[model samples]
Target: MMNHPVSPNAPTASRAIGPTEFRAAMGQFASGLTVVASLDASGNPVGLACQSFSSLSLDPQLVLVCIGKGSTSWPRIARTGRFSVSILAADQQEVCAALGSRGPDKFQTIPWIATAHGTVRIDGALAAIDCRIHDIYEAGDHLVVIGKVLDLATRQDGDPLLFFRSAFAKGLAA
Candidate 1:
């Protein structure tokens, strides 16, 4: 076998990875959209749309969501130590767009109800999960927020909203 000579100017894996390239690559993976919400210091609801939620454990019932460090809602949610995850339904694209945007009074145009745990749950969601912050770890540009599930509720029937290739889609086909 012949060995290939390495060029000093050749790009390495790290050097080849840029924000746009990395985002485009990751966008290929389809993910469910969720709105993670909590009450602010003044008892007002605050939340942001997240596509990085995942179930971490079953025995103790745990879930995880990644929040950008620059997100304004994260700080308020962190301070509360409790939050709710609303799994968006197929028709809830408007809800996702609203929450994901940067502005004040995100909840103004959306319908929601507050849980006993002081977190807001979006109406007509596929499912709503209430959790208390279990752990937090720093990931490169975001924080991995692990939550201990407290209570959860599901709609009788509905299709889920999905994100793929940087756009929203209905649930996958059977």
Candidate 2:
């Protein structure tokens, strides 16, 4: 038998190596999908589909989403000072695609209700979270936006949609 060397810090053989290489690797980690939306100062709505939403802390009622620096919606969201996160249900794929597009009139095709806080909330979403901008920090090519949840509402029943490995999938029961 031949001897093999392994570094202690080396990842398990099952782990894919390198960011670019691992990007192409198989195996899907399902994420709850959402549309992060806001209305500009002029009351025009802007939003984008994001699977990066995460619960950060309970004490402060904090939530986080990673927005690409190059995203058009980020600049618009930054200006608003507040935003609404609408957790997407499985049937809301059309709403997701519409908001994810590049260009104007992204909100034209969707039905939404604006919160008193001035954030646009997409209709039929699994849940809606209204937040005020807490902190924004630079993280690689993305900005990690931290929000302080001001209000939250949820629908009693709905199957959540999921995004995994660049494809649309269904959420599993918790």
Candidate 3:
């Protein structure tokens, strides 16, 4: 992991990323959009829109998502001990941004319901995986959350939302 800040003394160096280089580099790797959701101890729902979700292993039914260190949703989900991974459909951009915002009211704007484990399960997503936090490790400026899937649900037909070059895209045709 490299720790090169865009500027050493600048307070907002994080915003000064080399966009062209960053986009070009990340564009080479593709990912599906996912909304990582959970309920706080008081049953308040919190979630984040993530493009960094991945399948780590099938044998153990493991999955992982990267959440930034500054994210408000991460801590709440961590406290709850469980979460749900909602694979967004290609048309759910509004839901994505709503959950991706800062502070409270994130759940008020999105449509979801309680999962078997009491975590919030997003409605109309392509799939939803109920998970218990297996491990959370520090990875550069983000936290890599590893989860063991407890329950899984999927729809028969739906196109996934793809994230590439810092924007949303439709999944490729078969």
Candidate 4:
């Protein structure tokens, strides 16, 4: 094969991006806040606060959540092969903080319910989606988990919680 020089300006060209800069840039894109929860092998509830979640497909009823590789909760949840995604309401900042923290008993202070589908769903959320793990892909420092939605319910009527610029967004203007 003949060697060819690649242009530095090429979109796919390797380049260094500062972690802080990348994070900040990503923060510019607002994302809905959610909690991904499931029952452990011991029948205990466990979960994590997440913003990296989205709907992937309609016909297949698929959803996706990007979980950090370092997340201890994901492994535990993964073992069960099922989980629930609770989309937070705009007033649920405390719920997000509780799950985002490092400790056991996150559910001790937060309100949650056991779904008939064998997943843990947060109470008072805007919506809850129960799913079975469809597939998992290893990406750079994160695992992209694709879930096949088994069932879903709208728990409350309210504005969705949002994250932007590394913090929870204030209420939207009416």
lDDT of 4 by residue, 7-113 (tens): 88768855798999899999999889999999998999999999999999999899999999999899999999999999999888999999998787888888999
Write model 2 residue lDDT over 134-157, tens digit each, in one string. 999999999999999999899999
Candidate 4, poorest ten consecutive residues by summed lDDT: 6-15
Per-candidate TM-scores read 0.90, 0.85, 0.84, 0.91
lDDT by residue for model 1 over 131-164, one digit each (tens)? 9999999999899999999999999998889999
What is the Cα-based lDDT of residue 23 in candidate 2? 58
lDDT of each: 0.94, 0.88, 0.87, 0.93
What RMSD, rounded to one decimal, does every model reach? 4.5, 5.5, 6.7, 3.8
Going through the candidates in order, what is the number of backbone clashes in each? 0, 0, 0, 0
Task: Work out how many backbone clashes candidate 2 has.
Answer: 0
Ranking of models by lDDT: 1, 4, 2, 3
lDDT of 1 at 106: 91
Q: Give the alpha carbon lDDT tens digit for every residue of 1-174 in model 3.
A: 998767666675366669698879978787888899888888788889988889999999999999999997788889889999999998888888787778568777678979879788889999999999999999988999999999999999988878877777766668
Q: After superposition, how far is residue 74 of candidate 3 from its true place, in Å?
A: 0.6
- Give model 4 RMSD, 1 decimal: 3.8
Better of 3 and 4 by TM-score: 4
